[model samples]
Target: MDTLVLRLQPGDDLRAALDAVLKTDGIGGAAFVVSGIGSLRGAGIRFAGAETATRIEGDLEILTLAGTLSPDGSHLHLSVSDAAGRVSGGHAAPGCVVRTTAEILVAVLPEWRFSREPDPQTGYAELVPRRRSSQTL
Candidate 1:
C-alpha cells in the first residue's frame, strides 16, 4: 500500500480533486480516502433517502470524510458543521468548494482494482474489488 497526502486550495472542488488522483500516473487505479478535513464555502450533500443533494452555503467546517475511490466512480461520506454549530452529514457529492484548505490522506492499493456494478438487492451501483497480478499493473 502506498499513501498520498494532498492539501487542496481554496475554490477547489473537493470531489473533483479526489477523482483526478485516480488518473494520475502510479496511482494503480484504486485508492481509499483515509481521512480529510477542511473548510468549505459551500457543499452539496445528499441526505439518506434523498434523491438530490441539498446545497449548503456558508462557513462550514469539515469534521470527517472517508470512502473508496475507483476509476469507475467513488463513494464518499462526510460530516460538516456550520458556524451556528448545526451539523449535517451524508453522501459527499460534487460542488463542495473549499474555503481555506482541504487536507486529505489516501491509501493507494496497487494490487487491487475496484469498479462499480449494479447490485440487484440494493438497486444501486456498488463497489466490486478484485485482485490483479503485478503483470497487469
Candidate 2:
C-alpha cells in the first residue's frame, strides 16, 4: 500500500479536488483519511432519502470528515460547526468550498480496482471490488 497526501488551498472545492487527484493518479481504489482546519461559506449535505444535498449557509469549521473514495465514485460524510457551536453532519456532497486548507491522505490499493454498481435490493450505487485478473504462466 502507498499513501498520497494532498493539501487543498483556499477557494478550492473540497470534493472536486479529491476527485481530481484520484482520477489523475489513476487511483481506482483508495481510503481517504482527511483532516484540516478550514471554513466554508456553505455546505451541501444529503440526509436520508433525499435525492440531493441540502445547502446550509454560514462560515463553519470542518469538524469531522470520514469516508471511502474511488475513481468511479465516493461515499463521504462530513460534519461542521458554526460560530454558535451548533453542529451539523451528513453525506458530503459537491460545492463544499474550502476557506483555509484541507489536508487529505489517500491510502492507495494498487493491486485492486473499484467500481460502483446499482444494487437492486438497496436501489443505490454500491462499491464493488474489481481485483486484478491473474493467469498462470
Candidate 3:
C-alpha cells in the first residue's frame, strides 16, 4: 500500500477533489481514506434511509472522514460539527465546499482493484474487491 496526503484549499469540493485523485497517474485502482479532517463552508450529507442529501450550511468542521475509493465510485462517511457545536454524520456526498483547508490521508492499494456491482441482497451497487492479476503481496 502507498500513502497519499492531500490538502484541499478553500472553495474546493471535498468529494470532487478526492475523486480526481484516482485519475492521477500511478495512483492505482483502489484506495481507502484512512483519515480526514477539515473545515467546510457547507456540506451535503445523505442521512440514513434518505434518498437525497440534506444541505448543511454554516461554518462546519469535519470531525471525521473515512471510506473506500474505487474506480467505479466511492463510498465515504463523515461527521461534522457546526459553529454551535451541533454534530451531524452521514454518507458523504458531493457539493461539500471547503472553507479553510482539508487534510486527507489515503492508502492506495496498488495490488487490488475495486469495483461496484449490484448486489441482490442489498439492492444497491456495492464494493467488490479483487486482487490485480499482475500484482502480488
Model 1, span 42-131: residue lDDT tens? 899999999999999999999999999999888999999999999999999999999999999999999999999999999999999999
Per-residue lDDT of candidate 3, residues 55-103 (tens digit): 9998999999999998888899999999899999999999899999999
Considering lDDT, where higher is better, how would the candidates rank from best to worst?
1, 3, 2
User: What's the TM-score of every candidate structure?
Assistant: 0.97, 0.86, 0.96
Clashing pairs in 2: none
Q: How many pairs of residues in model 2 come into backbone collision?
A: 0
Whole-model lDDT values for every prediction: 0.95, 0.76, 0.94
Per-residue alpha-carbon lDDT of candidate 2 for residues 37-137, written as tens digits (9 for 90 to 100): 46777888897678889998878888887776777778888889988999988888999998777777667776767678899999999888767655410
TM-score of 3: 0.96
Model 1 lDDT, full chain set: 0.95
Least well predicted 10-residue stretch by lDDT in candidate 2: 28-37
